[model samples]
Target chain A: MARTDPDISPAPPATERGRRTRRKLLDAATIEFGERGFHEASIASITRRAGVALGSFYTYFGSKEAIFRDLVRDLSEGVRQAAAQSLAERELDALETERAALAAFLAFAREHKEIYRIIDESEFVDPESYRLHYEKTAERILGRLRAGAAAGQLRGDLDEAHAWAIMGMNVFLGLRYAVWSKGEEDRPEHAAQAAATILSEGIGPSDA
Target chain B: MARTDPDISPAPPATERGRRTRRKLLDAATIEFGERGFHEASIASITRRAGVALGSFYTYFGSKEAIFRDLVRDLSEGVRQAAAQSLAERELDALETERAALAAFLAFAREHKEIYRIIDESEFVDPESYRLHYEKTAERILGRLRAGAAAGQLRGDLDEAHAWAIMGMNVFLGLRYAVWSKGEEDRPEHAAQAAATILSEGIGPSDA
Candidate 1:
């Protein structure tokens, strides 16, 4: 297939077997890129990790840069799907929905610690993808905040800044509690509770 | 003069002229590394930008890596000093202090747009310095939060996680409003107000 959209993967595999092979390459690429970083990471190494023939790499990806870019998009999509799955399972109020989304994200980050490395590195290796990941994520959060305001669950004045603040909180919480947790008690749910509390009530004194 | 602390600069300049030269080199490195990135940035380019001799580069920094590491520290210290300078100018309450600090930060970021790139790239170039920068910043914020609680300005139950949340909020807000902003209306004070409102009342319904 001749895929024209540069933002997405080039020519997604047509057959099931082709798709499976592409998936394997992506999975392996994640590890290679995560471990070795963009400069040191090689197409041959990715193919070796994927157990695919080196020549077949071109069947799915145009170049190493192509695969790296696609992997970033893949990871961004993975984050969205993870949160979407969590949100779909409940009819949560706005605050509760945010809490669930954060919890789900924390879980995802902890499970795939490489996600932070890959995404953060994209800021240097592929600036456009790095900016897109955050812009898209913030837009999604802004939409949720507007919905919450419409439903009377959140302050009506909430805007883009609010969404950016919430996204920042979630990102750093995942960084500390999920990626750098030193103890078993520092769980995703604990971080979610803290973030949820911040969203529900400012850290100011109760009477203040 | 020989310096004992490896964590600090290689050696302390004994003369005012030497100090000025070192300062010039660091300023140049900031532009070089910020624009060209770490791996691509070179000592020769830094010297050219600084209007200093290449041999003089070694008088302050032992190597390119050394200067980058020191530059990260210098940037981190600069952020601390900015917040401290803002905090010292007033006797505001906890929330107001945060607002002032963030406002100062946004202003600083606007002036030195290269800061975000340097600090962020340190994650790959010098992981230890990157981690130390955040850990120390969070410690400082945590100390302020404890003081705020002690003074009855903030919630009594605030902890390390709360400090991280606030730090993340400030970092991302600076990224959006100061670094990536496209319009004139997106000012530092506006971002500070939004952050202050969140810190004071959160995004929950007003009644809550």
Candidate 2:
């Protein structure tokens, strides 16, 4: 999605080796920043963790702030790709698409438990990236809702607010069921089904 | 109710004047912490902002961390009161109650725009308080949902996941429509009504 700002970050790696090195740094950063936070994290620790040379850090990122900003966008892209992959796996109605999307998200969150910490920390480290993450996510969701409405499978009046609400629901559900999960009862699919039910029929009395 | 950790904070003021001074300090702390954040914020600055003696700060709170924790709890209390006052104004059906509470919350967020920053920052400054805030808020929502189901208003199958989903919906809606509101079209009631609609009826095709 070309989320990185050219002014702040270096151009993407043109070679396979360079790309692998950059990917390694971002993975190390996810753990470094996630464990120590922005103020405490350092390039030395990240490069060391990635097993890359210290001078190579500047090949992809300009500075600590630049890397942090890029990391936020990277994580946002990861979230987007997760949903995209899930939706592409099968043809489903609007509601099932949302269910499948959320299920994928929960699985992603569980695997990358530090994601919540990183994104939440972005509010302080890089406010613009933090804001963009949600804005872009809501835009994607609104687009889905519009398509659903066009297909006559969803209410035609759905708008930005609905998208934000659904985004919020999925984010918080992942926080509770995936990040803070206690045991087996907090299954990702179980949480996804509960959320999907809300979109499909709501919590209103069934007979009513 | 008593959200403060007694060991970290002092006893409540015994007299009205003492109470007033304590209240003033907390109000000032909100602005100080909200603007400068926890790290840059100082007891002297908070006292100066409150127009109280610096030494008197010790009477209410033990240290900077203590007051920050207390401030988080105070804001949490404010949120609770906002919902309680709205719910008390008039008897509402279960769905209407959710609408009113969200409307009140939106109004509160608009007035205290810095609230989102403060609460979100609490994740790093005082993890326990941040955790408590969401946990307690979700508990309150679940309580209301249980009451609704008991009264035969909502679906009997509603559970903790439903409460978390609704809480997430309200929080993100407030973040978008209230704290980051642009102008006239993003009215609090309008957003509240949209969310209430989700709870009242699923966004499925109406005829279905």
Candidate 3:
């Protein structure tokens, strides 16, 4: 939406530069924090990893905590967007819905392993950041469940608030695939199927 | 089971002393790693926290890594034992059976928060440990699922190999609730219900 002409070109805005720098710092922070945890990840390391310089790191964010808060916010939004996009692609049945959700989540985690690790390690530094992460995730899945329930696709006894917990459970499953299982395991699709099955059938006493 | 006289024991023996020392070090390590994390916790700090001399610390644990491995194994076994106990207590309906399993998991986590942290952090140290943890859990859960299937409780479409993935997912759910939820959200009961719904309903395409 910027008007650009030969003679009257808008001065390529300073805020845009800051925005780019901020994003770079966040990306670096994710990898760094993912590698060295939240507490151990120093600003110097983050800046070095970002290649943005130490002063620029401070210019863009207040502290490590600020970076983490923003990181959490970005991850929360990214997950919501991903799930929403995946949901929009089809009208799945109950089992297919979980498969779809698991596939979407596995894809998201594959792309953002650092962010997932950052969010997980954040539990050691600030409990609230961790809480907020799940709460946001819960909100998205709960929204889905509410819609599904209203549409008669889900059970009536479903706890709206616990939707994220269930989804988060699946989301965290991708972590094992990401961090633990090196290239030797089953494909993501198979894992998704497994998760879908477990979700649809109770591990203990499902009559299904 | 020892050949030593239990009826009139005086000194518990040098081997017993070493065992006691090792036990103390592991206990202290769990609390230390749980509170300060693995990287931040030092041998000196753990000994001080445990009120033991530095020399005695080395006498028990060769290094913190050894202590961490033991803790992870110990915790994993304890959790499985707890789950086994809960399964033993019930011939309940679908919902109650799932609920009982969840209750057992929550109880294990609550009592072993430190051990939980140790295993969680271990993923970063040697990625293999994470899979090792998952494999141990999966074998047990899959064994149970197979038993359930033979008993005609579980569905036929389930894969036994992916039991590790399912166990990985559920373990994270238990952990996410314990750590991410910060003891505020009580999802153990609800998790059982949601899991029951998933199993009975299937997350795949429904017949209706």
Candidate 4:
């Protein structure tokens, strides 16, 4: 299946069989890697979890690193698509728009905690993979900001470059409250509201 | 033995001999781990780079994981102390305070790129580590928001829990920007102003 996000595209498996096998491997890897870190996680365990031959694992990707890269590519694409879809569905009000964005992030993180964890851990294990993750997020966010600016919903004078900065802050909050704060008390919905407030308000009095 | 930030109580080596040896290891590990992915990096290579014995690596820390922990803890504390010191040095105006915070983050990232990279990477490897990081940062930002609220700088209507929601957003942004973007492209300073604008201002023109 194709990923809808513009910044990153999934390199879907070459054939139907490849796609099924690939999906199984990726899904298995995400959970395995999430539960046991990269160092502790093993391919044998992943393939067993996937119910595939160990040979098939290497047949699709060269190594664990390669599999992780594809996973990043997939998750990043998922995030972009989710963001775009959310933005598209919301009314043009700034508050509603921010809620839609943060909701999309929280939803994604909830469903794909393991994948996000893999991507997060991959940063040190593999900077290239992490770079791919950041580029996709920044690009997707910049696109939305550009649209917000053009619509006159977001502030003017600031460029897309800066809009991405705020997006980074808002989404990172969701990442923290959702992904990082597992089991601990969390208020993701309220957190989303606060971020939206900050995005809309600028921490200073209106006159300033 | 400890990381002592002259400005903030932090880290350094334990004994002079320990200091020299540990410095070589920490410095080497930073480059090795940050520049090379953790998996490809071996203790043998790290020892070689530090010009220390492989046996000596164990003396510093039981395992590579332990070394990574220290590096992460030290970096995390360094960042907190630096941000606090920045806030303390002056009675920064609202926007100025944001600028100082952003500038402090950039400085920390630049000075200890490896450490930031590791901490960022740690989220995936050990989520407990990531949670600790989030809590430490949440404490700093929330403290500021609480102080601001007391001074009537921020909206008192939002509870402490709500203030934390706001804090999550920035923690996310700092980690993403620190790890990925080069230069001042992810200008937290400017972004803070932009964000502060909305947190204080209602999304619409008047009600806030």
Candidate 5:
């Protein structure tokens, strides 16, 4: 189900300026919650970070919890767009699509290192958003799998479990190579290729 | 970084009776930390739950944070034991070993549904424990992959990324199918089979 729960949902800002301010607040909130966590973070700090007026905070978000929920959704959307942008750059088969999407995700995660902390904290701060984030991501992956199956690329029997497994793999790979990366040696492309190999050919020996 | 960091490490009990008391406190700590989390969880509550005297807490753990760290390590050991127990039951090839390990993990997660929350919360409460848990688990998985490769059952090129990917797949599958499971229909064996399929044969079409 879509996250139409109005109680936690922030109303969309109308004007172009309003949207930019909202985006700035979200970016600031990401850092706030990512570092300070839900309990330690405050609306005042987020507004200060965004350089927006304290009174203007309520114009968009109802409260701290509301913005945190919205932030998770925003991050989710960013993940979706990253994959979409990567897939649009060139034509590729289903396996390559997964590889490219993961590559994009790794690159995104590297830039936004706080993502894992903020998202993982949601499990406690806002359980609904936390669950929704993974559920929606898994759903998107399932959709892709189904499309691949329909195109006679992936296995016909791919199901929700398969989607979850793939999501798990991508998320963990990001955690290792992106979030906890040492340096340039932890290349996103190499990680993506490793995952692609698993999908294109299982880890079993080539002859096996 | 063997996690022998003296600050967080709990001392071993000197006698069998002392050991039992320590075990009782840890078991109670699991329920306490699992339910109330590290901050809300109190030593008195855990001691009361364990039916041990309040003074006995310090005999085992130094503080609430100490107990929480130990609890995470205990859970990590439990996971390791589950896989070890499963693998010990019979001889299997690389794919089968991975499948059986996941099956054991799913069963463990189902029985201890509080596991995901506890382990995840460790990320916020005890960052070192959280990172160590995953790192150690991934190392174990890599060990298995290496063993498989040496046995000629898996690709010789398998590395740390493959292990992390497999660990992620297992973790996410357990989250969806075990923790958030609807009912018996979400069988551990079924989820394990789905994961095993990915490792044995990629999700690509049979002929592809």
Candidate 6:
């Protein structure tokens, strides 16, 4: 159940039951950390919330910081899988691919509203994970942009800055339309379309 | 020195000397909070950094949290002023205005690298100020977008989502190019141009 990884945290559980226990702990930790924050959140509270014994907590995570770091990595992977699963369903054009990826992200954000809170909190609780999350995410976007550019679907000059720009656009759009707004007018589809339009055609007047 | 306002924090000092003291405390608090973070940071440390007595701390801030909130507001205003000052000297078109705003932001961010750390930490420490900061910043961008639309310089259908999109682009770009990268390749002017190009003409192929 304990495999040490130099990168982020300890390795995954070896058995199914162990995995289930770890998952429960993580789910509980998500709520604890999300609601109370890193400073106020406690290991005992997390164990109590998970319906697991305090002694068993050490089986998966070495410390509170370990669990928090793992949780951020888990969430980061969740974001990646959300988009990956969505992208696998169809062969989209470059612009459509970007739109689909964002749509998936928005849907994911709505389902797991704690995502923003937990991820934002990581900036303080685990600065390395926080930076790693964005750096990796930006790298993924850059890869897509490069592919699009090579395929002649996107502008030839697309670079890392462009990827960062697109990433920023998707993040804020999710923050507004997904996390903040409760109105029916602010659907993920609508947000996706607005973003897609920006990608396909800039906001400048056509005559310009 | 304190004027009670229903908004973010206490009002400005009536006397220049009092104003200077408050400014000193805020400046010192920036270093204290930036270095130690919110939880570990103390009022005594901030006062010590200010070269002022601990008893004089209350002359400006009612509590550590009050000063933290004020600091977030102050940094938010600083960001606004950075862009505002840049924009004031120019009579550029819509795209050029955005370019200037982003360039100014990038430059400001480079000088005050702690702006990112402080503003981001506010999400957990002071959620209201965090939300208000982005909301207000987005509103400002939206106003500019609307003005561009009205002047027929930008798309007439541009809305809040568009503003958020542009805001996100600028934020991440600043985070990457200004706060993170210490390399010569990541210049503010270059970032500004990349974003402006997206605003003028998106990532879509030119022939398309």
The TM-score values for the models, in the order shown, are 0.96, 0.96, 0.77, 0.77, 0.95, 0.94
Q: Rank by TM-score, highest first.
A: 2, 1, 5, 6, 3, 4
How would you class the docking of model 6? high
Separate clash counts for every candidate: 0, 0, 12, 24, 0, 0
In model 1, the runs with Cα more than 4 Å from the true position are: A1-9, B1-9
Write the residue-wise lDDT of candidate 5 on B161-189 in tens digits: 89999999999999999999988888877
The lDDT of model 1 is 0.90
Kindly list the per-residue Cα lDDT of model 6 for residues B91-186, writing each as its tens digit.
Answer: 988888888889999999899888888998899889899999999999999999999989999999898889999999999999999989869877
Q: On residues B78-118, what C-alpha lDDT tens digit does candidate 2 reach at each position?
A: 99999999899998998888889899899899888878999
For candidate 3, the per-residue lDDT at B45 reads 83
TM-score of chain B of 3: 0.77
Q: Individual DockQ of the candidates? A: 0.79, 0.81, 0.23, 0.35, 0.85, 0.83
lDDT per residue for candidate 3 within B54-122, as digits (tens), equals 977655555677667667776777777887788887576533554566668866786776766677677
Model 5 DockQ reads 0.85
RMSD of candidate 2 to true structure, Å: 3.6
Candidate topping DockQ = 5
lDDT of each: 0.90, 0.91, 0.65, 0.66, 0.91, 0.90
lDDT of 4 by residue, B76-182 (tens): 78888887798899897644565577567756765676766677666654556766876777676767766766676665544444445545434445555554455
Candidate 4 lDDT score at position B183: 59
What is the fraction of true interface contacts found in candidate 6?
0.85
Output the lDDT of residue A18, model 3. 75
What lDDT does model 2 reach?
A: 0.91
Residue B68 C-alpha lDDT in model 1? 95
The single-chain TM-score for chain B of candidate 1 is 0.95
lDDT of 5 by residue, A1-208 (tens): 7545434545788899999999999999999988898889999999999999999988888778789888988998899899999999999888888888999999999889889999999899889989999999999899999999999999999999999999999999999999998787888777888899999888999997
lDDT of 2 at B182: 78
What is the DockQ (computed on Cα atoms) for candidate 3?
0.23
Which number leads on lDDT? 2
